[model samples]
Target chain A: MLKAIKGIPLYLLALFLFIVTGLPFLIMFLTSFKGQMEFMTSPWSFPESFSLDNYKLLAELQFFGYFANSLVVSVVSVIIVILIAAMASYPLARLKFRLNRPIFILFMVGMMIPIHTTLVPIFILTNKMGLYDSLFGLIGPYIAFALPISIVIFTQFMRDIPKELEESAKMDGCSHLRLFWSIIFPLLTPAVATVAIYNFIHIWNEFIFALVLTNSTQNATLPIGLREFYGEFSVNIPGIMAALTLGSLPLLLVYFIAQEKIVTGLAAGSVKG
Target chain B: MSRLQEISLDTVHVRKKKKNKDTWVIIGFIAPAFIIYGVYVIYSIFMTFYYSTFDWTGIDANMVFVGLDNYIQLFQDDVFWTSIQNNFLLVIASLLTQLPVGLIMALLLFSPIKGMRLFRSVYFMPFLMSTVAIGILFIFIYEGNYGLLNAILEGIGLESLQTAWIGKESTAIWAVIATVCWQFAPFYMILFRATMVGIPEELYEAADIDGASGWQRFKSITLPLLKPIIITSAILSVIGSLKYFDLIYVMTGGGPNNSTELMATYMYKQTFTNFNMGYGSSISFSMFIIAFIVTVFILLGDRSTRGNG
Candidate 1:
């Protein structure tokens, strides 16, 4: 009992942070279920009754279209990033070449360059390529910005792969492509998961590129779509809350389901740098 | 002797041919990522600089070469200066708040406190939610009249402290800064927690044998070991704070008298909102330079400290 008393302050601090971090989400979630009248009448109180009206309103407003756009963009970009970044990492991790060090440094430097710095030129390039205001336009820049870190993670993982596997394959006359496909690439499951999760989260939540490169509602990703909801539904606070809740749901759901994968993946991705 | 020399020459020629083949293979592997990264990142950086010299609005072909005039004007622009100041202020505020708060939270996870799994899951949830959602949610939370923050203050008998948190110039930046900390501190917590978990158990056992207290153990062993990750987190926070957008843009649009205007937000308004593409490029390029310089400086300082230690 005395030891438990000594632990009270620790529990208090933990609970305080819990409320600080978790309360806003609770309020957002609970407020999402209240009717407009209830929300306006007593904003902090528990909802008198959980209503699906706000969610139904979102459904009528084509909310799922934004989800599809975000899904397509994130999936396509992550797949391409994994394939090419892993391919590039094979040579970078194992090969001896004149430009290897310089190339690696160049990609690493991309991490520090502000995305805003590349904004104007990419906008122009997208326009000139006739890809402006389209989902396809967002993919190019997404793949580009994701390469640096993806390569970093991939190369770090690849270096640990045993050389004996490659040497034996080479003795069987396996070409570099075949060697990579048969040996190196197969050994990269953990790294691929890490890259995919890290990039998926970033691209799914990406704002500036989507905001700039795509202008139409059909092409708008979730972050931009949520902002659009905010503008149109400003007076409808509960409805807006519902949109925010639904918008945040997919990622929160994924995080809960695969909590360890994401936590370790993100840590691995960043701690390497 | 001649036959031996012939064999040696033949082997050398074959090896050279293999080296050439390997070069082709390497290029083949690297070309796709390099092309994409080049056009979007490297090429865009140079183009940003090139466009900064022009007087063209992004919509039209009427490009007038301004020859560094935009940068010169940026130097004199009051809003630009204010935005720069705010960005630095964010950097400092984030370092001070996010890192320490993250450390405290991570430490609490390892404490004898109950229900830590639940605590950790909730702690990390804020980070998973999109930043735009956080910004919009907090907008209402900071809303003056019916906002949760004000209501809570009133409920707790702190009615005088309540106001439109983001509506006033004085409180706006700090309010957004607090929100920023809320969203990101958990990320740093994960980083610190991962490092802390890797710390060997024997060190604490050794400390206990010497009668060291909890704070003393943390100070002597944990803090010293945490130095590398702390530096890395600081670098990330500083660069992220400098280039911050989206949340600030969504929440305030850098408003209530432009109090929270970051470089990125200001650049967005200038280029996209006002069609000052040339000037916006300058601001963004300046951001690039500032981020680059700070990263290099931190890395160098980190390297030198490592050398001394």
Candidate 2:
């Protein structure tokens, strides 16, 4: 009975979680293929015509502007995040500085604070700096926000790098920079991969920063683009569904492909708890 | 003896030279990050307050002091109170749901299962999707007609459970709560499992030698070892829920007579929507205060627990 109980739950949970996670996506995909009447009548049922009409229609609308903006912001932000975080993590982690832990803790504290409290200030500062409407506005906050975890993870990996290895490099007349670039970097692949996946998904899914920072459709990210389907009074359900499917598909592909590292990254990202 | 003094002097000279050289290198590495992060954190916090005191519209700087008025209004406002209540409820619901579900899921994953690698990724998929999409997804799921939730309930002949999930004043909060729980459970599940996996297998062996039942062993060994992680997760949950806005904003928009107005959403409404920027800043100030206090409480709790043990 005990064995049966344990056995039953895993199976049931697996099924429940699978359907729960997969169903919304499935609905979006199917709804995009079906006509309005079919969606209204039988959303759960499969499409009768199997047409690409919805995609073609949305494409004609040139929703691709929003799509391109999203891709650029997420891609650029991810790249910048990886570069800045990788560069910043080194000295804090490896060097013998007095302020290492405290400086890290300060950033960690910054991480712990919610973005809402910081938004007003960011808005004011960015407006003053004339970056409000620019895509580059997010570069600063994105770096600040993503840096703590990236540093923490990188630092953990660095600390774990055997001291003897560094000492050996030192004995061989290598400068610290040379040691970091060659010996330390090549070995930190897993953690770096982990940080990249973590940063990519976060910047991809983020909405608040995107919403406040960008006003025009050309500057907006995918999440804001989807909001166009929602008006003050009414909602265009089918259109929004299509846009959501398009918006989330890239991350979903990444998620499905490189899932384990993403999971570890997500785990580490939230482990401040 | 003369040779020894010469060696000591040589060592001191090398140490001074190395320290002098490394100081510049350290400054090079540390200065840029310090300036950027410092301005972002310290300046932004002050900006929240400065924005709170002004009556200027967003763009132009026609600033006027509404000193203490925003605070007074916030104190008197029913919506603000409701928002605070909602945030507390959110914190409770998160603890209630994320803790057990995450722990159970973690336990199941930890239990020598196959295909967990795939399942772990699958569980995290919703998390990758934007909260906006998830909010939209749950909205349809909770719609009055043709919703998956209602359909499933009606199909099972539990028609009483088929009432409007997000539509009514009564059920909107629960609907939002479910959405929050669904998205975040995987996060805690991973955290708990990671810490759980780090516990030595030998402890379990020792427990078995003492004729400890599975439940007993878990209670005695696992719970004690996992206290730190559990506390950490609880603090995270508290803070996350306290400041939760995006999901609530998208799902219900804190609507149907504002049943779901979380603190963060309320603040957003005041500052941006109502143009009461000062009042919003007051709320943001309070928000900062609440966050600091809550964090302090959790840290103190961590200290006491470790001290007791």
Provide per-model DockQ scores.
0.64, 0.50
Error of 1 at B92 (Å): 0.4
lDDT of 2 by residue, A6-112 (tens): 56666777667767766777887776677777777886678897777666766876578877776777778667666656656777777887887887787677656
lDDT of 1 at A114: 95
The CA lDDT at A138 in model 1 is: 97
Model 1 stretches with alpha carbons more than 4 Å out: A1-5
How would you class the docking of model 2? medium
Where does model 2 exceed 4 Å of error?
A: A1-6, A171-173, A232-236, B1-14, B110-121, B197-214
User: Best-fitting candidate, measured by TM-score?
Assistant: 1
Per-candidate local distance difference test:
0.93, 0.77
Model 2 lDDT per residue over B123-147, tens place: 6677778888888877888888888
Error of 1 at B229 (Å): 1.0
Q: Report the TM-score of candidate 2, chain B only.
A: 0.90
Error of 1 at B155 (Å): 1.1
Residues A1-273 of candidate 1 have per-residue lDDT tens digits of 112235878899899999999999899889899887887788889998898999999999989999999999999999999999999988999999989999999999999999999999999999999999999999999999999999999999988888898998899999999999988887899899999998998999999999999999988999999999999998889899999999999999999999998998898888886
